[model samples]
Target: MRRFTRPKVIPLLAKKPPSQLPHLSPIPNPSLPQPPQNPSPPSPILTLSHTQNHTHLLTFIKTHIKNPPLTPKTLLHFLKSKLHHHPTFTHLDFHVFNWASTVDSYRHDHSTFEWMVCSLANTARFSELGCLLSFIVANPCPCSDGIFSCPRTEPIFRFAISAYCRVGRLDDAVRAFDSMRKLIDGKASVVVYNILINGFVKCGEHDKALWFYERMVRDRVKGDVFTFNILISSYCRNSQFGLALELFKDMRGKGCSPNVVSFNTLIKGFFREGKFEDGIEMAYEMIEFGCEFSSVTCEILVDGLCREGQVEEACELLIDFSRKGVVPRGYDYYGLVEVLCRKGNSERALEVVDELWRMRNVPSLIACTTLVEGLRRSARIDEALEVMGRMLEVDMVPDIVTFNCLLQDLCNLGRTEEADNLSLLSSTKGLELDATAYTILASGYSREGKKKEGKVVVDEMLDMGFIPDLATYNRLANG
Candidate 1:
């Protein structure tokens, strides 16, 4: 026992070697504050996401809602208040609706679903629309008492398909149309097919539109005027005028009378195909059918004839139809007037304007402005001033651009006094003078060697925060 003790004492006496000591981490700074063992919960994330839709919806409802227990009426009001006019933030409404579907406390009513679909469709959120439709189809509203049915479900699908066609998503539109048939209570309305046909036509898939029309006919859905019109327009756009005329005849045979739009489409098609005579014939035919000319019909006739260098014919047609009360009021006769003015026939332009004025169809400001510009260009300054006076008497003040033209003409002719008087008169008449007016006056003064007047105008410009360029300032300084 003594020998063993001596042997151990030889190692223990050296005081454990440095390598034999236990390794330990360095101690943290005692002056620094220690982190909390349990930190406060993170602030709720303010995010718009599908996964967090329920949480966000609850948060929004708590902030904006007022009723103790949410009812359809109160929820609808809350939704409309937030979503009705705010087109950009409509996704929040969808999120709320989605969250509402999960709750048994309330159910979405018919009006709510209709409004949501309309809002989504109108805003062109077709992808969201598709998802919404799927949700409605899969999980019908609880208000129906376990019946997964909606009266307006077909209409909503129809709108989505129509919108899809408008944006060139033909496949999605067709899929929606197909899905609609299974959901609708009765046979799909012709309006639904008409929408698809029109969409195909608008997207330039003319053959596909025609094919879809055939499918509608085969499906035994009674084609209406809208259905025939879509086909006619599509045929016309594809330059298949023969097919368009045939469809027009078929529309009549089927007892579906053509309206102003139908005739206008054919007439425009005729003009597009360089068949002006055919277009004119179509107009008379429209009258025989008791269809009054729409504004579009008048524009087509007048603008088409004018473009074909038959301004005189177009003018005569306009006057004749206007007197007969066939064309709508406010038809643009100025197109013909502008054409005459461009031909340096200001006399004819003035005559047309007077004729319209006598009929109590006062010319637009653009009409007066155009005539004044024409007169000025032809060096007929006196006539231009006369026209300007007429505009004022009619309470149609000249725009700044027209006023500036007159001022420039006067200054160029060394009539600075007249220009200055006109400026004062314009301001009195409520035409706010801009910096250009003052600069024009100053330039005129400088040109006429009126140094005092020029200096005063420049100082006014400077006081108004309009610093002239270096060259302009040097000229003003010299003046």
Candidate 2:
């Protein structure tokens, strides 16, 4: 206790060591030996897993089945439960099912199997669908009497064959029909042959579609309204409007009433060949035949009339149709406006534009530009400016075309000051003044001997990233 008291009395002073601390010695590196590397294990052959392959098989089946229509989700669930974890079940499962059930289920349920067959054929997977037909040929489904029936005996098979033909898979479709014929002991029905003919027509294989028609007549497949409609539509689509008209006559001669679709197709075909009057006549004929004119028919009439510079007639027709409570749906009034404007009748065109606006449909940028250009060309500069202002007021920003039109009009009218002001406004609004607009302004300035002003405009144009064209450059150089 006395020593501690004395140490405390010394103010607890500690001794100072050298400036640097002692360093520890480094350890020696150990020499570690490397182990021998073993050869890599052989990679497994990467076939699809059972679940993945089953999913693909189900997808294939669902794709083929459209009628007794099983969706992909339903088919996947069915396969998961029915073919569970099976490796060999590819797209051929449904094919086997269709064939086997056909023979066994004739007495149990004929309609259900037929429905399945029709559904399978409508699926775009022709190759997988062909598998079903092949299975049917090998193992024919039975008839109502419980006797094994040939594939041709089933109407569903015929429907499938026809669907294939419609989609331009004519060769495979023909093979299916042939298989059915052999199975049915050469007793193919008129309905089956008609389907094949219709398929060819639908696929734009007009020649083949027509060939099938001839074959049907040769085989005495009863020509009905359905048969005529298909062939007529095929001719119309193939630009053979005259042939389509002839077919229409033939149908009427055979006491088959021409349906609205037939009339519409003919009218559209005529319009396609630039025969507006003929198309209009067909529309009239549709009404005479007690076939009500659809909106599509009205549109065809309107488009044809407008294209032929008879926009006044088109507008009258539209107004008349609207008054008659037959407002044409999906009809473009913009096209009408364009045709009218192109004919140098922008005032009449504006009437159509106003009509569309009232109907809550604004004309497109193209129609707006066309109208403005027409107004300018007619020396109606003030009216064109008013239209541009109205467009902007409607929150329609002026595109490059709008600016070009306005600039040209202003320059043409010797209003270069206004044009220059407008160009500045365009730049401030982030609207790029194109080379045409610049050239117009530059030429206007140069023509008045305002060389300095023209050079300033040229510099501004270059600053705005527009390279003046040859005319603009020559004018600046000559001036």
Clash count, one per candidate: 0, 6
Candidate 2 local lDDT, 1-479, one digit each (tens):
01111111110112123332111111122344535544864211112334455456545544554444233344445444544345575334343343223221112133434544664665466654675566455444434223335343547667777677667788888888888765554446767777788777766678987887888787766688778878878887777778888989988998888777788788888878887777777766665567776767776788778767677889876655554444544455667777777778888877766666556556666777778887877777887886776676566667887678788778777888788887776566567667788788889887777878888888777677675476755555455
Best by TM-score: 1
Question: Least accurate stretch of 10 residues (summed lDDT) in model 1?
Answer: 4-13
lDDT of 1 by residue, 118-143 (tens): 77788787766777766555444443
* lDDT score for candidate 2 against the true structure: 0.63
Q: Against the true structure, what is each candidate's TM-score? A: 0.64, 0.50
Candidate 2 similarity to native, TM-score? 0.50
